[model samples]
Target: MSENRAFFRETVEQILADTLDQSRIEASERRMLPAALYKALEENGVTRMLVPEGKGGIGADIGDSFAILRAMGAAAAPGPIVETMLGNKLLAEAGLEPADGLIALAFADDGAAVLHAVPWGGGVDHVLAVTPSGISLSASASWEMEAALDAADEPRDTLRGSLGAIVALDTSATLRTAAILRAGQMLGAIEWTLARSIDYAGERKQFGREISKFQVIQQMLAELAAQLLASAGIAEAAADAGRETLIAAARSRLGDAADAAIGIGHQVHGAMGFSKEYALNHRTRRLMAWRDDFGSVQFWRRRLAGGFVTCSREEFWPAIADAGNRRAA
Candidate 1:
């Protein structure tokens, strides 16, 4: 990481450490936004981290912003931080003024009146809607919301109304960016689970000794670690490069990693892992909820496969080679 990136990461970590706790997280899950936490994030420039420097943002690189996102996931910080950051950037890109307070992001078909399962939809200041044709922003007062929750118990409300005039833009890039940033969140959650499982294994004794001593437990942890490593590498690269094919690959690969993290992280802890009071459950449930956000694993898999199948036999290897090239010109 660059010096600037390190500073951003540390600042996010400190904010999370100070503002987030069990009660606040639980409150968010119950559909109450953590107002103070969002305030702190905004005060620290995190909310506008991606907008241009002249526009009151840090003008941070995509990779640096993504690192902060990963930290948010690891801390299991609540609310729509990811959406707000990207929404502000997109708003600036369109020469539109950024909205105040929280922003919720959603995708709907062109000409659609209702947007469903929008993250933090009911409580945001504005909604940044991305469609096949373009993007638009609408104030919260312009729409009606039916409150709901996702598997993670976070707000995933439905909005019924029209967004403002759509500005022409590359919607695919918008969706890909959302998908890969989500993949980074999943990566951090998986990392937390693996670490938590490891710690539990070391301290929790079975029959005669620590569960960490068992060959089977060691094998499982090792396998989970391997998955986490691979997922992290690809997720970071996709964020840095913002390549469509690479983002597809990262999302698909992280789906597998999430599956492993939930399985192994719980299996090691036995019944204790399933309890709501346990920290492991928090990250695991989020992994389940977030895996299909922006797009599903099957959608990305099809996207990845579709990207390569269009190439002739002679162009196949180079295409695969190109997708993995993070710094490709």
Candidate 2:
């Protein structure tokens, strides 16, 4: 890792270690924001990491931001961390001042009347709406909110309101940006699951021996480790390249990795993994919740397939080669 990224990761890890805990994570599960944790993030300028340096931010690279997000996922840090970081950048790009407190993020469709599954819609006072025309900020009071939750029991409310004032900007990149970042989160959660499961296997007893000694158990963990490495590599590439096709592929591949984590991790832990009180359930459930965010696995798979389906036999190889070269560049 670069010096800056290593420092960035250490800082995020410290903030999370200091401000986030099991109790706070449980409160978040019940739909409450970890105010202290977010306050620490804001106080440290972590929330504004993406905004340009000219606009009161450190102007950190996407890799730096991705490392923080991956750490958040591993820790299961609650609230709209990703949303706030990206939202501040959007606001700065539009020459608007940075927002305090939490900000929900949504990409509104053309002629869409309501924004659905908005992350932390009810908890946050502001929403950053990115559309084909422009990006805009809308106050929470202007909208009627319908309460909802994702698989992890985190808020994913719906909102109906005007987008307030629109700021002209190219809004095409938001979804891809969100997708690759969310994929990083998913990768982190999967990593947690695999680590927890392996540790448990080593300590768990079966047939007068550690379960980890069994060939079956060893194979399962080995497979999960392989999946984690693959997901981590692709996710890093997607975050670095920011290509729509690469992001789609990364999200789709990570979906399978998440499933493996949930299945293998739970199988290793047996009944303990299913308990609501156990820590493993937290990361596993989040894997289910976040896998579909930004875009569903099926949706991304279809998107990736669409890119290749239109090519002839002669053109397919070159298209694939070009994509790889572009991503490498």
Candidate 3:
């Protein structure tokens, strides 16, 4: 890793350590991070890391942003980090001011459908909704509410109904970026699950011996570690590939990691893992919910398969070679 990226990771790690209130986060679940935490992040410009310096942001690269996001996922910080950061990048690229609070886009199945802005909570100053076709800006409108599919209990809602309007920015790149960001978040969750499970096994005892001493327990941990490492590598490679490549890689790995991590984590902790009082449960639940968000594993798998089927084997090799060369160079 570059020194700059190391520094960026350290900076985010410190910010999360110092500012994120674990007690409050555990209590609220999905209800946005505390106002104080949000203020601190905003004051430090963590929330706008993707925007250009000229646009009142730190002008960080995607790699740096992903590192920060990975830290957030590891810590399990509440609120919509992917949605907000991607929205900030989209707005900056569009020459618009980055809006504060939660910002996510709502898209229809039709390829040319307009995306509408949905706030994280009830109200925000502005919302930017971008689609592959174009960018849409709405300042005054009643935000629609839909139920979130994730496990977080805090204020989760989706956007729907006629109160919302869509604009066309044709920004497929931004949507792809958001997907990559989600993959980073998944990586963090997987890492946390593996580490936590190992720790729990070592400390928790069964039959007068440490559970970690058991071959069965060790195998599970080893498998989770391998999956986590592979997923992390794929996610990083995908992010470097840009847009669709990143999304495909992330979708493939995150789903597998989430399933493996959550299952093993619960097994290691046994009943404790399912208890709401346990921290492991908190992290695992979010992993379960997030895996389905953006696009479910099945959804992305079909999409990826479709893409591959449409291309001849000859065409696929060149695309893979080109992507590898881009990352290498």
Candidate 4:
């Protein structure tokens, strides 16, 4: 890793370690994020890492930002940090001021249809509509609550928007950006699940011995480790390449890893994991939410298939070659 990247990762780890209060995460599971927790993130520069130095930020790169996102996911802490950072960049790109207070993003596929899946809609002060077409800058004050969960208890709500008001942002590139970040989040989640499961297996006695000594438990961990490593590699590769197909592929793999990690993690923890008190739920629940946040494995799989279907068999090989060459450059 680059020295800067190592430094960035260390800083993010420190900030999360110090500020990620378990009570705060548990509270966010039932209600909106606590204001004090948000303030801690902002004060620690977690919220402004991506903002340019000229714009009162530390001007961190996307790699550094990914490190933070992964750390947050691993901790299963609550906030709109990713959404806020992405929104700020989008607004700056279109020559507008950033939104104040908590920010969230909602997806819009149709230019004229109102999007209903505005994340954290109930508590967010402002939300921007993200579509394959463009991004909206107009702030919506009134949000009708339609609470939904993608398997996690974190707040998710619905809202509508006028697409015409949005600027014509690069939708393809934007999707890649979101996919990469989501992949990073998944990586963190899987890492936590695998590591936690191993620790639990070692501590939990079964058949008059530590479960970690059993072949079954060891096998599960090996599989989990393989999945985690694969997901991590895919996330890093997607970031390094910055290609839509690569990002979609990474998302697909990472989503699969999230599923396996969560399942194996809970299984290892047994009844305790299913209960409301265990810390295992916090991280696994976030993985559940993240798997479908940007695009699930199925969603990205279709996207990846479409890319191949559009290209003739004769052209497919050359396209792959060209993409590899571009990455090598």
Candidate 5:
């Protein structure tokens, strides 16, 4: 890893350790991390990791930002680091002031769901709403907050306001950026789930032996570990790749990772895993929710397949290679 990435990893890990305080709360409580953790991040400049130094941000590279986000996911911190950083980057790139609060790109259900301008409430201060046409932003509109469906089927309130300004820019780049960040979060979740499951298995008893000693248990753990590692590798590679390629890789790897981690984690924990009292449920629930957040596994798989089918093999290889080169440069 580069020095910047290593530093980012260390910084985020420390922040998560201090803020998460494993003994004080369970996983369910973690969902509130974004609201609770926001102050610390703002004070520590964590939220500005991707913003330019001149713009009061840490000006970290995309790879560095991904590392920090992954660590946050591992700790199950509920902050909107990915949304803030990426949104800020997009706004700054667009020559606009970075609006405050959590800014996320919303995709219309219409199959195209590209970038279309839509009015959003001012409560969020910033938002990226995508339609089939292009990206749109509303910084000054009054927001009306109402509950909306999140990836996990939980009711997440969305701020609906007027369109202060609409910019019809191709959002393929922005969509790709969001996908890479989301993939990093998934990687972190998989890592944390696998480690926690292993720890639980070693301590929990079954059939007069530690559950970890059982061949069946060991096999499950092995599979979970493999999935975790594989997903982490793919996510890291995707982060290193530029936008489009990152989206493609992340769409596939993140979904697989989330499903595998949740499946094996619940299996290892069994009945206890389902209980809200158990900390495992927190991670598993989020994993389930996150899998469908930006897009579901099936959604991305179809997207990747469709893209591949339309492009020649020669063209496809070059696209992937170009993404890698951009990251290196």
Candidate 6:
């Protein structure tokens, strides 16, 4: 089983290596969907990765889904891969077959459904209207995407047209699933940022010595490495346990890693990191944007606080310890 997982991981890595070239990243950043790359993901079964094979899908578990998400994050594959995977899972949960083509979160505002900061919203054929009432699938109201600054530049669009059909499912489940997926994506972002930072630090010289040799630079790298490991652990635990609190913690931890790693990444890259032409921004911008994607740090922090409030003073330490014990195991 482990070997199978390893092979899948390598296969994903190779696919991203071949598909997410510099040209595609730039085009995606410009809010344009790389049609070929999107089709490649579909052909490889990633579009239906989370759905069961019996349902005309791949039937991949959360672990496999997350692995693919992380690879996309690392490669800066821009589109609705995450949205499509989670949306398909939710639809399957409701025993509803998702409409073909890409899918995105359908944000609710009053009576209308809207999508804000939607990745590749313009590129998708369907906008998933996940509301408190139920889950509704709407055809792309309009591909007329509004503007966004984050170079991942996933076109954000609003839903104006009438909804087709809706399903009954807990809204929290969708949020938790999306949040967990975002956390996994952060793992890839942090890793990609660290890889770039280390490479730059080792190559760029200061005072006839590589920047990587400096104690300050080394310390920052070490801190990012430690945080990345913790972030990965939190994400894995949340995926395994399905605890809302753990999921929130994973998102919070990911936000923390984004804060630190984004700083260290740009610091090592100097001015070039922020330059529009540089590849570092492709990964780093997404990290920064995703920190607040599903839920910001403050939001998750409040969610965690609510969870802890249930425990009495006497049970506090035990509760915390038990959670840690479970994570360790």
User: Model 2: residues >4 Å from true position, as ranges?
Assistant: 325-329
lDDT of 2 by residue, 1-329 (tens): 78998899899899989988888999997888888889889988988999988888889977789988899999998788889898988899888889887899988865466999998987887888888988888787778999999888899999986667678888778887888878878888998899899899989998899999999999999999999999898789878878877888889889999999999999999999999889887898899999998889999888777778877999989988766333311
In model 3, where do residues sit more than 4 Å from their true spots? 30-32, 108-126, 139-141, 144-149, 160-168, 310-329
- Could you tell me the lDDT of residue 74 within candidate 3? 86
Residues 1-329, candidate 6: write the lDDT tens digits: 26655666677788787767878878875667777777777788778888888887888777777777788888877777788888887788788895588897765643553456666555678777777767877666554456555535656554345455567777756777788887778889899999889999999999999999999999999999998999888888787666777887888888889988889999989998889788888888788778887778889878776766777999877877666332211
lDDT per residue (tens digit) for residues 58-134 in model 3: 99888787888888788887776676777787777777788876565544443432233232533344445555555
The models' CA-based lDDT, in order, is 0.87, 0.86, 0.70, 0.74, 0.66, 0.76
What value does the lDDT take at residue 142 in candidate 2? Answer: 78
Please identify model 4 stretches exceeding 4 Å from their true place. Answer: 109-113, 131-133, 160-164, 310-329
Estimate candidate 3's alpha-carbon lDDT, on a 0 to 1 scale. Answer: 0.70
TM-scores of the candidates are: 0.95, 0.96, 0.86, 0.89, 0.81, 0.92
Ranking by TM-score: 2, 1, 6, 4, 3, 5
lDDT of 1 by residue, 171-190 (tens): 66788888877776788899
Please estimate how well model 1 matches the true structure, expressed as its whole-model Cα lDDT: 0.87
Clashes of each: 0, 0, 11, 0, 10, 0
- Model number with the top lDDT: 1
Model 1 steric clash pairs? none
